[model samples]
Target: MTKVKIASTTDVSSDKVLKTSANGKSVLVAKVGDNYCAIANKCPHFGLPLAKGKFENGVITCPFHGSKFEICTGKNVEWVDSFVGIPLPAIAQKMIAMGKSPTDVANFAVTQEGTDLFIDS
Candidate 1:
């Protein structure tokens, strides 16, 4: 478990992204109040760079498809049995191996100390 310094407290503003490295993997950090939170920079749903998106009420909305995801939870904004409810414009995709879901493949984490954020790859 490696911890990398991604940004200085003065660098990222609340609701912004700061890229970091922990265990040789790219991670995304976001400002929440006076503290910072980190998560995988790649979107679990579409593998997009979440750093280019916006954060609102602890959730980050993907710019590519406007899909909302919980930064702290790393889960889709809404769901019911492997289905997405949001109508945001999205790219067509090959379905997940039937019955399976995106949540099955996502394993993002968020941690912080003061204004510094950390992630585990």
Candidate 2:
């Protein structure tokens, strides 16, 4: 595994996310309590950056399609359930999903050395 330097501990706070790249792959790093997590920055629904989405309680919701994913484990919590910021019906959600199955986002192992943060890529 290659350890790629991402940011300093001070660069990311509990309420903020640090957007960076590791080995040519875009990633978003967040500090949860005293631990740190790194996940793919792109949302699988529309291939858009997830940094603009909402992150809460270890889950990140895709802004475009409202797909919720577990930030730490890269698990899919919910598929497309909304359009933009408006809630959609189940039938509408399925239609908008375009037959795409729910997929988890990619996650990287994060390690902190002193005040520097690193991710394995």
Alpha carbon lDDT at 111, candidate 2: 90
In model 2, which residue pairs have backbone atoms overlapping below 3 Å?
A: none
Which number leads on TM-score? 2
- In angstroms, the error of model 1 at 73 is 2.8
Residue range 1-121, candidate 1, lDDT tens digits: 6555666666666756777666766666666664566677776665767677667777776665455666655667632222242342222322322332444114355555676545555
Can you tell me which runs of candidate 1 are displaced by over 4 Å? 79-117
Cα-based TM-score, every candidate = 0.62, 0.94
Q: What is the lDDT of residue 115 in candidate 2?
A: 94
The C-alpha lDDT values of all candidates are 0.58, 0.87
lDDT of 2 by residue, 1-121 (tens): 8889998988887776778998899999888877898899988877888888888887888889999888788899999998887999999999989999999998888898999999888
lDDT for 108 in candidate 1 is: 54
| Candidate 2 lowest-lDDT run of ten | 9-18
